[model samples]
Target: MTTLLAARSDRPVQFLWGTNVLVEEAALQDIVRDDVRLPEAGPTCEDLAPARFVTNPAALEEVFLAGMNAVARMDGAPPITSVVVRIQGWREGHGIPAAAESSPYVGWCCLFATPAPSTAESGCLSLADPRAGSDLTAMPGLPWGRQVLIRPVPGALAIAPGWLTHSVVPIEHGQQLVMAVATCSR
Candidate 1:
């Protein structure tokens, strides 16, 4: 029998997941429209949204900070150094495939898989088993055997360690929007 332990760190992976209405739809729309223009491409998701980046919209910063605090508490307080923000979009045919990898930052905040009011299918997040070998950590965009797709709630924030390999599942229908925040500590 494949026994699964419910202990926090002993599990295949560990992450902070919560739902809070922190940002508004209108605000989110504006952020995407007026604020997403980056001088250059963001960190590779393919370091992240710059290795350290935040939302141009102040309203979204509060939401990101809240997530940072939660992840910080889980980890004994570390001095945060930088933050980066970016918006990721997905449609029926185009989506980022999963891989076995982790981030280079101290923590990351992502509002993954936003709902498509016009569609019924929900996109899911496939996270690799934390217990897997380190080889998996560097090879992102490639799928592994042990991973799971998690459905995300709009307005809910997912704050997790920088080293957990995760990716968005192929969106079968409609569009999926995401607000990504990456942070570093020194």
Candidate 2:
């Protein structure tokens, strides 16, 4: 069954979450840790995309398509075949420092490729209230204060609209391993 997660029932943004354990959790962790090992100044979106990742294509595809389908269900959109999926992991100091933003996708899926830290500051995904609505504003001001926090659970999945003003709180404790899959569809 699908469950809706929102700060307010009237909110325009829809966040859905559930569990999906990978068959080989260790493989996902190895791929991400290797990518983030003593490298770039900060993690970029491209770093998370699947092209740069070294994991089984089937595993990625299985999760990606399942995620897109869930996105379609939430937004009442059509699920088109052939959507690009990307994923990356951000350890402490590698996650988004500040600012919540959106991307160009119907929606996306985020799951723990590896176990996440217990501390909430371990780069958890924080999002503004969806009641802010999805539209360009005359004045660019986000309701950052009205936010909801999603602490990634191992083998769990959270899906939300790309338009939601969301950011990863900087990882302060252990590493937070996340696998994100996005698909751009009109």
Candidate 3:
């Protein structure tokens, strides 16, 4: 079995990940349906974006608590006071590269839900290893030099090395709603 290693602060950069386990489609829909205006990337609109994070602060708090507990179980680290979840668009650049190897920051997790596809298995998160090689240098604020698509399941989440280059595949045909929250030890 491949065991996950706790990130050493002295490493170039690292991330610990966790999730809230139960983000129902109906709950997502409720947030989207109640929106007065949809999030725009111009012409195209995402039915549900990450804005609902603040809409239900209490729920987020619960998620925060749960996520912290999960992280503590894995890393033996304490919980953080707050986190930020951002709704990302397909065209948005994954910010894995910008963080410098010498930077003192850890990693983040992007939690999402997607419908299963016909004629194929469903709910898989995509990834690109950020530490594959330092051959490719990155600008300050970008994640991977190339794109890595991840499709995680409902009530399921992936906790990979934070600096690992990664992103979500476009939820093209399915009714997928996504939310990404970043957590760190206090």
Candidate 4:
């Protein structure tokens, strides 16, 4: 696992990302197929509870646990005791809206699949600065008010703080698939 972005005194965002090779190809294929087969709930995307449909639930949970442990170690916090996983398939011209997880949840992790051919602007994850009034001033050599954009890559896994506001860029050409996990410590 790699620390894509580490939280510092100046910048509070802590983002950990890496590619998980432990998940077998068959399992990923199964997940994509299952997501595709699910009925669309809205005009822009399809959502499914992965735990209820995934063929290898244990393997999926193991992946989540790996991310959770990494997050716990980084924050010097207690071990994560719960996770809620969801499979989201986004259609062209649509993406997830900006939002942050509520109380009881400490953070969120996401696993990505190889999306259909698209540019960096399509389906990229956007993490906003959490500091209040940081956007009011733009100064050189400062991390304040800056936004981080992570492009979607196959097998990519990212874990970030729940309080950090985040959103996804719209799919420009093809569909984008993601397995989103919400982590919490009891």
Candidate 5:
């Protein structure tokens, strides 16, 4: 069974995580094969298949719905009217630079062949504190000033607000794959 987890903060930033999502082996192989065939050096999203490429599209959609509902409930944000789904692959030493989504929300599902090793936060999603000037203080019992790291485990999904600044830690060894979903309110 799939389970959804949420990381709530006193600040505005929040993250939703889904675990135990099921994807067919064939689908996984197809995505990896296509990624390997591509010639891009850094993270590549071009020519990737749509969300339908996944054998079980409903599983991912569930995560998306949960994220949308969370945003609506907590932030009282507008409903998401559209979403752009893409498959992204990262090779060794390649990682996404820190950036915020232009849309209202963003979701990602790790499709790696294996879980990233725990050392040095390999292939982990890193989220920065959204509050400005929070880094200036070093106090106990404070959520700000520390980054939230989400390890890369196959079938693990994460969703966060678009305004949240986030990036991926470069993998030291193997390739890292993920399905990215961006949501629009308009």
Candidate 6:
């Protein structure tokens, strides 16, 4: 029989059965907005929020513990682990690139899907591989965990191996609010 693990929330985003993992969005968002420190990037100043914040220290601790629990189930994977709540908006090539080598941990990209803007041009989320020796033009198909592309519905989650290279398309001048927590390690 398949055993299902319990999550912090009962929302559909918490379900763990897809190309990308999911986490409850509302609660997760509240926790992040109440705790973390969002910074700005120098380059595009768009790679990330370019600016944002994380809330709820206690909740963050819980996320870390949960991450550790996931690592423990990996059998022989490394012990290092981390949990983070990330926020970003529309940008040409956003997000971290995939790794060139293999890692011993996993990553969960919990997309907080809110209401879609009036138009697709308003905001969009896209992902790609980097370590495969690829630039924006030379990138190949979304690597392994990078198969599914989501438009993020507030309260939706997207979790996958941490090594997966992902990015957000661009927000133009509209509002595309998305928050994700990635649990990963070396």
| Predicted candidate 2, C-alpha RMSD | 8.8
Q: Give candidates' CA RMSD values in order.
A: 9.6, 8.8, 9.5, 7.5, 8.6, 11.1
Please give, for residues 71-173, the per-residue lDDT of candidate 3 as tens digits.
5555555555554444433222212222322211122233343345441323234455444333333532223443333444433434443444444443344
lDDT of 2 by residue, 78-139 (tens): 76464565666666665553343344332334445344466655666665434432333322
- The order of the candidates by lDDT, greatest first, is 5, 4, 2, 1, 6, 3
- lDDT of model 6 at residue 118? 59
Q: After superposition, how far is residue 185 of candidate 4 from its true place, in Å?
A: 3.6
Give the lDDT of residue 56 in candidate 6.
56
Candidate 4 accuracy as TM-score: 0.64
Clash count, candidate 1: 15
Off by over 4 Å in 1: 1-56, 100-122, 133-148
Worst 10 residues of 4 by lDDT: 18-27
Q: Scored by Cα lDDT, where does model 3 land?
A: 0.38
**Over 4 Å off, model 6:** 1-26, 29-53, 64-76, 84-115, 119-124, 127-146, 178-183
lDDT of each candidate versus the true structure: 0.43, 0.48, 0.38, 0.54, 0.55, 0.41
Task: Using TM-score as the measure, name the better of candidate 4 and candidate 5.
Answer: 5
- Which candidate achieves the best TM-score against the true structure? 5
Model 6 agreement with the true structure over 63-142: per-residue lDDT tens digits: 65465445445434455545444444333223333332143333333333334555663333343444343233222443
Which digits, one per residue and each the tens of the lDDT, describe model 1 over residues 1-186? 022335666556433222111222222443333332223322323322522233344556555555565566645666444454554544455445544324433222344443443433345554554443333334332223445444544444455555555566555544444445445444
Q: Against the hidden reference, what TM-scores do the models get?
A: 0.50, 0.53, 0.43, 0.64, 0.64, 0.46
Candidate 3 off by > 4 Å:
1-55, 88-124, 128-154, 173-176
- Report model 3's TM-score to 2 decimal places: 0.43
Instruction: Give the local distance difference test score of model 5.
Output: 0.55
The local lDDT score (0 to 100) that residue 96 gets in candidate 4 is 70
Q: Between candidates 3 and 4, which one is better according to lDDT? A: 4
